[model samples]
Target chain A: MRRRLDMQLDELNELLTHMGELCQVAINKATKALKNGDVSQAKKVQKADMKIDQIEKDIESLCMKMLLEQQPVARDLRQVSAALKMITDMERIGDQTSDIAEIVISENITESMELVELTQMAEAAGKMVKDSVRAYVNQDLSLTRKVIEADDEVDRMFVENKKELVEYIAKDKGKHGERAMDLIMVAKYLERIGDHATNIAEWVEYSITGIRIEGN
Target chain B: MRRRLDMQLDELNELLTHMGELCQVAINKATKALKNGDVSQAKKVQKADMKIDQIEKDIESLCMKMLLEQQPVARDLRQVSAALKMITDMERIGDQTSDIAEIVISENITESMELVELTQMAEAAGKMVKDSVRAYVNQDLSLTRKVIEADDEVDRMFVENKKELVEYIAKDKGKHGERAMDLIMVAKYLERIGDHATNIAEWVEYSITGIRIEGN
Candidate 1:
């Protein structure tokens, strides 16, 4: 029975890794679509989000089953409960990526140098998502802390991006204000993605140390 | 053992209700701060969020203990799991309300007629939080649906508020543009509060019917 529970735990890790990869793809494609002004690419990101949502439900039921059947305790219980918490943040990352895609397609924003910083912000957030999940799969405590610290950079970028966008709107007045607003919204979504990644890392830390980190 | 489990469930319900009340206070104070441009009031919202966070941690531990010790199955399992999911959203509502208050205090937005619609939006979101928690506490299926449906109105208000803020910014060019941007951020936060409330309502529905409502 112990060996069976261990095997199921391994399976859970694999499933979570797969979900994390999907989130990376969603954020990557959404930001790429934003950079290239490729409507089809944005549409693809939206479609992929549905799959992420389905996977979340599958993982949730599996966790519930493990709790019921294996009756995990202590560290094992933390692992299962943390996975349950981590997936919600992962799912939100997917949803926010889809939201960015929707903005890209609806705004029909053409490629511009203006989006360079926003793209960089998206890349930073996506890397955090990847590293945070890897931290959990490997139980790398240092990597989790790295993911947490990286959130500050994404947040700083958001403030800078907003300032730049506001200036653009100020310069163009009514002419390009809506487009500037759209880009600001995109930046905000990326920042939120970063925040969710930080949340996942914090949960990973809790699983490992049995200590919950405040203010993610 | 069954009676003990029932008693524990009732305790969980009471804890959740208290947490929900804290969320309501957070939202109410944040919006009131926005309406009055009272920076101190906004600061109070930030401080109150810490209490909400502490309560969420307490509630989470209770849920985990109930799950492990009681080893509840079927309907009881669903109730415990649903509580777990509901608290995350509730915690987010608290965080978003704090975010709104941060903007209000930092932007130093003075009282203006411009805030009327945004205040209304905040009120609508707060009501949803109250009703969703009430629905969960009472297990009222109809109230759950009502909370779900009210999200549409909050959403519509967000769109209208955004349009109005954009117009305000466009007309003023750079002078009031930052303030306008801050108001828009406040509006976005309120919309997210509405979404989180909808999520709680969906979990309430799931606890009652075992049917998950998709796309809140």
Candidate 2:
């Protein structure tokens, strides 16, 4: 029974890794849609969200099975529960990327500088999400810490983008104000994606180290 | 040992209720300060925040003890984890409220109708929070639904206030513009409080029913 339980843990770990990969793919495609102005690519992202949602449901069902059939105790329960919570944040990050795709569908990006910056932000957040899940799988406390530290940069960029966009609207006086607002919101969405990734990283830390890191 | 375990659970329940009361107090005091332009009261809310932080830490420690000593599985684990997650959002609401209090201190709100509307918005949010926590404590799913429904009203009020504030700024630029911005921030803060309370109520439902409520 113990060996079977370990096998189940291994399977769950692999599923988590697969979920991380799918999330990365969604983020990369969303950013590609923004860069190439590819409406189809953006639409592809929207359609692919159903798969991400399905994976979340699968993970939840796995967690439920582990709880009911395996009856994991101590750190194992924490691990499964943390996986359940971490997937929630991952799915949210995917949703935020879709929001960015919708923004791409709305406004014309005559210039590439803003789109480039936003893509870099999204890429940074995507990398954080990947590293956090990897760390959770490996139980590497130090890697989780790095992911947590990365959130500060995300927040700073978000604030800077907002201030600049607001200033642009103030100066232009309704000229491209809507577009600028959309840009600002896209940045805001990326920043929140970073936050959810940080939440994932913190969950990793807690499942291993039993510490809750928030607001600091 | 069973008696001790039950006692610990009771203590935890009491502590959670205490935290809920503190959140309500913070919301009330912060709104009152913003409405009355009471610097002293604002300062008091700021000062009391440290105490809230201490309570959060204390609760976390209790949760850690319960998890380690009692080896709680499934439902009990979910309860403690949800409380931990809820505390993070509750503390954020408090910080945002403090931000509003500071804005009132820094910027005068002498004659802005938007400020008045924001205060009412905060009151609506506070009522939702109070009701939701009550529902969670009682396991009253119907009351929880009511709390969730009230969130739409708070969100509508926020939008109405934001639209009117924008009009106020556009019509009379630089006249009460700063105060209008402050009022807008306060409204955003209260809306966020409603969001967090909704999350807590949703968790309560899941704890009872094993069902997930998306974005509740």
Candidate 3:
């Protein structure tokens, strides 16, 4: 039974790690599509949304089944729950990708807006997602803490970009307002993705230490 | 065992309803405090953040326990998963309320100056939350759909308010640019609460009908 539990956890952990990779790929593809004004690619992201949704549901059902049959306790229980919760963030990240794609498809974010800062935010957030999952799989507390701290930088970028975007849109008043709002929301969405990644990191900390993070 | 499952579900659902009520109240308190410049009230909302977090942890543990023991199938599984999912949104709504309260406490939203529209958005969002929760507890799909549709209005208000606030703050430039950005974030946060309410309503629909309503 112990060996089987370990085997089961390894499989579930692999699936979760793969899901995180899929989310990262989706975020990158969608952001690239946004930067390049590729409506077709944007549509592809939207079309692919169902895959992420289905994967989350599949993972959820599998987790429940494991609990019923395996009766995992302590660290095992934490792992399953973390996977369960991680998928929610993964799905929302997928949705944000879709939102970014939708904005591109609408042809509104077409302004040759130098999005260097926004890209940085996306990179930080995506890295956080990746690191948090790896941290969970390896039970690396330091890596998880790193992800949490990176999220603060991502949020700071989001607020700074939003402030600049608001001023840029205000100068033009409605001409750039719509697209600008979309960009801001996209940044906001990514910041939220960071927030969720922090959540995953916190769960990792809790799973290891049995001490919940403060101010989650 | 069947009776026990039913009773556990009833308790879970009741707890869900109460959490939803707390969400509505918290959002209302935060937004009113935003408009009225009531820093003390905002501080009170900030303090409630921990309560929401505690409730979320409680609900999460309960759901896990239920899933572990009952091995619920079909409708039962849906209810448990929906409750788990709804609490994530509820926790986020709580966070947004706290975010709003903190922004208000900082006096930034007031410095941006066009407050009436945001107040209206808050009122509409607050109402949507009430209806969303009612639909969840009562299993009223009609009401659930109504809340979903109302999100469009809330979203529209978000756009209009952003535009107006931008224009208003543009007049002063340096006077209000930074604070205006925070105000926009606060407005976006309120809009997100409405989005979460719609998400809860969708989960309610799924809980009742076992049909996933992702889009349309």
Model 1: how far is B83 from its true place, Å?
2.8
C-alpha RMSD of each candidate structure in angstroms: 5.5, 8.6, 4.8
Give lDDT per model, in order.
0.87, 0.75, 0.82
Cα deviation of B148, candidate 3, in Å: 5.2
Supply the TM-score for candidate 2.
Answer: 0.56
Candidate 2 CAPRI level: incorrect
TM-score against truth, every candidate: 0.72, 0.56, 0.76
Ranking by lDDT: 1, 3, 2
Candidate 1 structure quality by residue, lDDT tens digits, B117-209: 887898899999999999998999999889889999998998788677677776775676777777777787788899899999999889989
lDDT of 2 by residue, B92-122 (tens): 6666677667667766656524367777787
lDDT of 3 by residue, A67-101 (tens): 99999898888888878877887887887788678
Clashing pairs in 1: none
Candidate 3 residue pairs in backbone clash: none
Chain B structural similarity (TM-score) per candidate = 0.95, 0.90, 0.91
Off by over 4 Å in 2: A32-40, A105-113, A214-216, B1-216
What ranking of all candidate models by DockQ puts the best one first?
Answer: 3, 1, 2
Residue A175 in candidate 3, Cα distance off native in Å: 3.9
Q: What would the per-residue lDDT of candidate 1 be over residues A32-96, giving only the tens digit for each residue?
A: 88877788999999989999999999999999999999899999999999999999999989989
